[model samples]
Each structure stands twice: as structure tokens, then as C-alpha cells.
Target: MGELIAVYLTVHTPRYCTYETAFAGKLAHPDFRAVRDGLVEQGRQLAGVQPDAIVINSCHLVATFPTVVDGTPRHRGILTAQEAPELIHGVEYDFPGDYELASAIIDRGRAAGHVCTLAADVHYPLDYGTVMPLVCYLDRTQRIPVVPVSVTLANDLEECFTWGQYVVRAVRERRRRAAFVASGSVSHKLVRGPERWPSPEDQELDHRFARMLADGEYEKLWAWLPEYAETVEAEMGGRHLAMMLGAILESGRRFAAALHAYGPSSGSGNYVISLS
Candidate 1:
């Protein structure tokens, strides 16, 4: 059976890509630069583990079904994020895709009553939420293959968790070393300006949620997630986080969770964390 080597939660703000220029003036802000730098280090550490594949659930890849797995054997793209083209435009990326593993995920998810399907078209492009983290975390060559999964807007948090369980099973049955990544932010209630921060109430909610993850209070976090997502407008409806948690907890393995850094992006709380 394949082993899940690690799990990570990362932010996908285009600002992360242009921190040196777009955010250069705001570099002095607490946790802004630190979070970015910490994610780089964490990416290096993940690369050192030499995983066979990295299964990523990107908030940007939204689906109406319960799940969708990218089964394309090869991925090549030049991404210019629509949300903030000025920050991340004309970025080229080419990487190997784990079609075998992705297919397994789809089969297993379907068997588990999820609406899972393979997206095999070469025309399918990688979203910024997927590419941004790969750019920050992987080597310039991107030696490891990736299996990108989409977050379903129609699914509730519990359904996302169930899909995650199926994903864990698919990975283990394939018998490859893999890592799971959740790419999104928290308290994603947008304000008028890009530099704005979320309200104090929303910030506090993010703080508490981060603490729960760091403390390994998975049960509590899972219990509170539904209400919290509705109240704080969590990114991708917190489906990405729910899936990450389900994969980790359902694996029946113990992981040490750490909060690497937390920052603000357009009034949203962006947190970087590692579960090893």
C-alpha cells in the first residue's frame, strides 16, 4: 500500500508570487514575509522526502460534482491568474502527472458513492491555486508528479471529508509514497482593497482554527468546521481543509501538526501549516 508521507495547508494568493514587487512595500508587515519564506522552507523539506506523487486539492479548481481527478499524463501551461493577472501572469509550468494514481482515486471515489471522474484532456490547464504552491515548494525542475483534485462547491463539509477518505484509500492501495496538499485560505471574506484585513471577529476565528490544527485537535476542528465556514466565509467553503483533515485522520496514522505561519491577503487569513 502507498504511504501518506505528509500533509500541508498553503495559501495561493497571487501576491505570494510577486511578494518581492507587489508586496515589497509591505514587507515589514508581521508574518507576511515570514509566511512566504516558511512555505519555501517547508517545500524544500517536502521535496527531501522524495514522495512519488503529491496529491493536491486546489480551491481554484471548483467542481459541481463531488470530486474530479486530473488524469492527464502530462501537464504544460502558461498561467495568468484571472483574479490578479498583474501579480501572476504568463507563468510557464510543465510537469509529469500521475495518471495511474489519479485513475485509482476516481475509481475508488466512485465506488464510495462520490461523483468522481477523470479529466484527461491536454487542454485542461492548471489553476493558480495548484501552480503557485508548486512554484514555491518544488524545485525549478519539479521532479515529482502531481495528481490534482478539485473542490466541489455542491458538496458539504462532511461529503468532502468522505471524499478525502476515499482518496487516502486510493493512495495506500497504489503503494506509492505520497503527500497531500490543501491550497486555499481561511476567512475569505473579501473587502474593498487588496491590502485590507478581515474584521476582528473573522481574524479571531482564523486564529482559533489555526490553533486547533496546530494542537492536533482534529475532532474539535471537524466539529466546528461547518458552522465556522458559514460564519467566516471560508475559502472554497473550507472543502479543501475538510479533505486534508479527512485524509490525515482517516489514514489511522499519527501526525505532528505545526503552524508555520499565518498572514493576511485581501482581508482573508492565509495560513501555512505542515502535518508530518
Candidate 2:
């Protein structure tokens, strides 16, 4: 059986690509640069694992009815983010897709009584939440193939977690070494200004959540998720984290969790963490 080699939680801000210097300048205050650098280091570690494919759960691609997997054999597009064109305009990307593994995930999810489908649209462009980390962490040549999974907003936390369990089973049944990435921020309560930070209460919540993750307290995290998501205004309704937790739990293995870095961006708490 194939094993999950590593799991990562990473931030997906265009600022990492568009405003590196400005982001780094605030290192003394919030250490944004350190977080970015730490993610790069984590990426390097992932590369060393030599995974055949990386299954990514992206918060940006929210599906309504069934969970969607990007199964295109090849992906190439120019991304101009609708949410923030100024930050991520005309960004071109080309990456190989893992059709075989993606198809297996869809079948496995359906067998498990979850709504899942494969997306083979050649014109489909990836959102920044999926692209930014790929750009920063993976090699430019894109040696490893990717299986991009979408988050379902209509699915509650439990459903999302069940979908993740299906993903884990699919990867293992295929007998392929894989790495899983959860790309999103936490405590996302947008305010008027881009430079503003989250409230002190939100910051504390972020820290506690991070601590729970580091301590491998999945039960506690799940128990507190409903209230915590509402209180902190979690990004993507906390589906990304829910999916990651599900995958970790389904693996039936204990991981040494590490909090690589954490910082704030536009009132959101961005964190870089690794589980291995």
C-alpha cells in the first residue's frame, strides 16, 4: 500500500509573488518573510520525498453540488484573480496533471457515498490558492504531477472530512507515494484596509487553533470547529482544515507536527505547518 509521505498547511497570498520586498520589510513586526521562507523550506522537504503525485485541497475552488477534481492531463493558463486582479494579474502557469490518480479519487469518493466528479476542462484556470504555493514550493519545471481537489461549500465539516477519508483511501489503493497540501489561511475576517490585522480576539483564536494542530489534538479541534469558525470567521468556512484533519486521521498513523511559521495578512491568520 502507498503511504502518505507528508502533509502541509500553507498560505496562498499573491503578495508572496507580487510584493516580496514589501512583505519582507515587515519581518521585524509580523515576520511575513520568515513564514514565506519557511514554506519554501517545507517545499524543499516535500521535493526530497520524491512523491509521484501531490493531492492538493484548495479553498479557492468552491464547488456546489459534487466535489470536483481537476483531471486535465495538462494545465496551462493565465490567471488574473477576480478577487484581487491588482495582486495576481497575468500570472501564467503550466503544470502536469495526474489523470489516473484523480479518476481513482472520484470513483472512491462516489463508492463512499460522497458526491465527487472529475473536471477535464482544458480552459479551466487554477485559482491563486492552488497556484501560489506551487510556484513557491515546487520546482519550476514541475516534475511531479498534481491532483487538484476542490472544496465543497455546501458540505458541512463532517461531510468534508468524509470526502478526505475517501481521498486517503484512493491514494493508498493506487500504490503511489503522495504528498497532501491544504492551501488556505485561517481566521479570515476581511476589513476595509489591506494592511489591517485581525482583532486581538481573533489572533488568540488563531494561536489556539495552531496549538491544537501542533499537539495533534484532532478530536479537540473538531469539537471546537463550529463555534471557532463562526467566532474567528474562518476562511473558506474552514473546509480546507477539515479536509486535512480527515486525511490525517484516516491515515491511521501518528505524525510529528511542526508549526513552521505564522503571520497575519489583511486581517487573516496565515500559517505554515508540516506533519510528517
Candidate 3:
């Protein structure tokens, strides 16, 4: 049977060396450096697990109402992120796409009355949110196949969780060893400073949420997500977090979650964490 070996939560930024050499400079912020190191460690642990495929859901790839799944067998592109063209432009990405796994997720979601769709076009683009993590967490040597999913902003938190449930069912059915990566930020209340933390109110909520995650308080975390998302301006309405939460917690598995590192990005809160 297939198994999910680990769940990793990370923040993607165009300023990272792997993503943008031009803008890459010393990570002066202690917490930001720690986050970088933590991500490297997570990638190392993931490599050791030798997962059959990596399933990622990116906040930048938000869909209207359906969860978009990449069904293309091969993904090759030169990404110039419209959002941050100066930092992340003309970055080449060529990797194997998990067609079989993507198909399974789509089938299972539809069967379960969830909204999911497939993208098979070879020319489909990769967003910075998806590309940044791939380059940072993986290298040319790994060559691991990936299945990318998109955020559905129109859906409620419960629906996102249901989408995750379908993913679990599909993974088990296909007997694929998989790793899940949720790439986004917390307390995404943009301000002037790139290194500035969110406002005091949002910072408090973000820390509370982080505490709950690290403590493995899934029940309380789920109960608090709606309020947290609404109050804190969580990135992409906290859709990415909800889906990741569903994938791990809905599996009925207990994880000893570790907060590897956390930092601030343009007034938002970010972290590199592993649920293992």
C-alpha cells in the first residue's frame, strides 16, 4: 500500500538564492537564515525517505472553484514570474510530472464529489510559489517526479479538507509512497519592510497558530483556522494550509510536528516545519 512519509510546510520567496541569484544576498535576519537551514534539513530528510513522488499545492496557483492538478508527464518551462519579474525571471525548470498520481487524485476527488480538474498541456506555466520550493528543496541529482495542485479560493475550509481526503484515498489506492509540501505564508498582511513582522495583533495570532501546530493540537488548530484566516489575512485565505492540514490530519495519523524555523517576509509570517 502507498504511504505518505512526511508533510513539509515551507515559505517560498523570490529572494532565495536558488530562485533568484541577482537578488540573493546574505540572509541577515537570524530567523530567516534559520528558516533556510531548516528547509535544507527538511529536504535532506525527505531524500532519505526516498518518496516515490512529491505532491505540492501552491498558493500562487489559485483556481476559480476547482483544484487544478498537473497531469502532464513532463514539465519543462522558463518561468518569469509576473508578480516579481525583477527577482524571478527566465528561470528554467524541467522535471518529471507524476501523471499516474495526478490521475489518481483527480479520479478520487471526482468520485468523492470534490471539485478537481486536470491540466495536461505541456505549455502550462509554473508559478514562483511552485518553482521556488522545487529548486530549493530539491536538486538536479534527485529528479523526483512532482504532482502540483492549485489552491481553490472559492471553496470553504471543509471543502479543501475533502480535497485532501481524496488525495489520501488515491495515494493509498495507487500504492505510491508520497511526500506532501504546502508552500505559502502565514499572517500575510503586507507592509513596507521585507523583514518586518506582521502587526502586533496578527503576529499574536500567527504565533498562537504556530504553537498549536508544533504542539500537535490538530483539533484546536482546525477549530481556530477560520477565525485565524479571517482575522490575520492569511495567504490565499489559508486554503493551502487547510489542504495540508486535511492531508495529514484526515489520514488519522499522529505526527510529532517540529517547528524547524520561522521568519518574517514583507510583514508576513513564514516557517519551515515538518510533520513526521
lDDT of each: 0.82, 0.79, 0.79
Tens digit per residue, CA lDDT, model 1, 1-276: 688888888878876655353224445355467667767767767867778888999999988865789988888888988888877888888888999889988898777677777988788988989987886564446778889999998888888898788778888889878899999998999875656678999989999998888888888899999999899999988999899889988887777876778777778988888887
Candidate 3 lDDT over residue span 74-146, tens digit each: 8889888887787677878888888888999999888877777899989988788888777766443438888
Per-candidate TM-scores read: 0.92, 0.91, 0.92
Q: Give candidates' CA RMSD values in order.
A: 2.3, 2.4, 2.2
Residue 115 CA displacement from its true place in model 3, Å:
3.4
Backbone clash pairs for candidate 1 read: 1-175, 2-172, 2-175, 2-176
Structural RMSD, model 2: 2.4
Candidate 3 weakest ten by summed lDDT: 16-25
How close to the true structure is residue 164 of candidate 3, measured as C-alpha lDDT?
74
- Top candidate on lDDT is 1
Query: Which residue pairs clash within candidate 2?
Result: none
